[model samples]
Target: MTPEHWLNIATHGLALEAAARVRAEYLAHLEDALEAGESAEAVLREWGDPHTANRELSKAHLTTREARYLPAGYAPTWAGLGRALGEDAVPLLLFALTALAELRSGETAITLALLLAIVAAALLRWLVLSRQMLAARGRATLYWLLSFPTVLMAMSCAVLASRGAEGWHEAGRLLWERGWTGLLIVAYLLYHFSRLLTALSAARKAEAQL
Candidate 1:
């Protein structure tokens, strides 16, 4: 069968409870617009894929993405900031934790220096990584990604990094203690989330509920 045919069959035949809810919701909306003469097929066509539908429903229930932009020290446009933040997170986390551990024991001078060295390495990775220039594209909404596991990972890492800095846990706190860095990442995630929500909320409703 063709890809579209398979997509339709698969989405229509899916038996998950959540999928049922989405289908039900779509139909409810479609029913309310019956005078418009739009069939479920037409509605689904505009809505795109079942994957997209799933993402919309999930974003309604979750925070969705993390580190969508760069911090105040980062001097670039939103796209540049997003790339830099995502690229920097892991290595920075590694460095901060390692450095903090050494610091707590009062002997991190060299270790701290090494962590400083990694800052550039992380920047290099961010510079060379396989990120799509999301902020650069006005149409790059993340709605079709929520149900996907990666979206959750992105969401979780961003959340942990934010709250990870707020308490007495020095290592974890230091990991995100760069103050504005946290804000940059949170703002970026928010922007990405807003786009995802807009797409999910605006998706055309389907008829003849599954």
Candidate 2:
């Protein structure tokens, strides 16, 4: 290995260390915000910076072996997937995103999205997170429970148009009002509108509150 090799490898090593350090720093920044009574959006602002930090890795690309546990052509098994999620950190993130969603936005549209996300998280938690959680007690039940939301949501959507019940009626009405055909016609406009409203509301509220 020449200076470039030494430089690349040495830089890669430092980058990995720095990446961990920076990630910890980012977490601490988020924790500090939470500690200081800053909102989830504040944590989001603090955490988003680390992506630019990740780009620092672009100083040199790492080999596949250097990046992931598996070297080349390694296929994932159910056990691998389960083990990956079963870890402590994975649960923490699942909890964190769900927590942030709960804290940051608490309304119909946003709340529903977050709640759906929570179910997804739970599914991950049960199916995936438990794979990582070493203690692994009482997980089976939790996993089964997590499956309910996914099923419920799917069922809700399926029955939404077919039934006269309150939930179904609401779904049907929402779909009818939105008119999916028209949505595709004005998709970009609708996308822009939704994004504008979300961004504007966040900014407006952040300014007002601060």
Candidate 3:
């Protein structure tokens, strides 16, 4: 049978998200088989009955918690953040607790730092998880959004490392008190933005070749 025929039967009772992944995987397998000189019939015979395969695949898919966290598909930026939170729930909770502690102790800088860290983490997680579902341009956009904070962090590191021991101490102090750390965050973000653009350019080239 053709790959589409198998896919239709295999995905018959599956949810949209699960079906998409199964379809993609099956298509890849079909590609490999065809490339290896195997006939469609042979591939079908080796792959087994689509209905049976779908049942088995669906069983595993339905049992997973990950599907609830970040199922495949594109979403708006806000939804992406929700997915990221779901995916990294435990770590985020811990970070929240730390931030709260810092706040209670009047460590505004530390609290702000923690909050920024969470934002960065959220952005990174969303980009990584959702990139596949995104178009090449969307993927590039998300990466660009991520680069801004990264650039800031890198710059802050550079500034902190710029001088001798005394200068290092001074710079470090200035980073928090003078709000240079905030600048650092901004720099980091810009850097990620640039990286995303670079990746997008590469993807465009690759697509052009195709």
Using TM-score as the measure, which candidate wins?
3
lDDT of 3 by residue, 1-210 (tens): 677888898777654656677788888988998999998899899889988987786555432332222224336578777876565566557757877777767766744664566567666757575556666556555544443345345545665667557777876566578586768755766765666655555445334323
Write down the TM-score of every candidate. Answer: 0.23, 0.22, 0.33
Error of 1 at 118 (Å): 24
How many clashes would you count in candidate 2?
A: 10
Candidate 3, run of 10 with poorest lDDT: 62-71
State the weakest 10-residue window (summed lDDT) of model 2: 66-75
Query: What's the best-to-worst order under TM-score?
Result: 3, 1, 2
Error of 2 at 7 (Å): 55
Query: What residue runs in model 1 are displaced by over 4 Å at the alpha carbon?
Result: 1-143, 146-176, 205-210
lDDT (Cα, tens digit) per residue for candidate 2, span 81-125: 444334334444564566576775564453455445554654465
Better of 2 and 3 by TM-score: 3
Of the two candidates 1 and 2, the one with more favorable lDDT, higher being better, is 1
Error of 1 at 154 (Å): 4.4
Superior candidate under lDDT, 1 versus 3: 3
Sort by lDDT, best first: what order?
Answer: 3, 1, 2
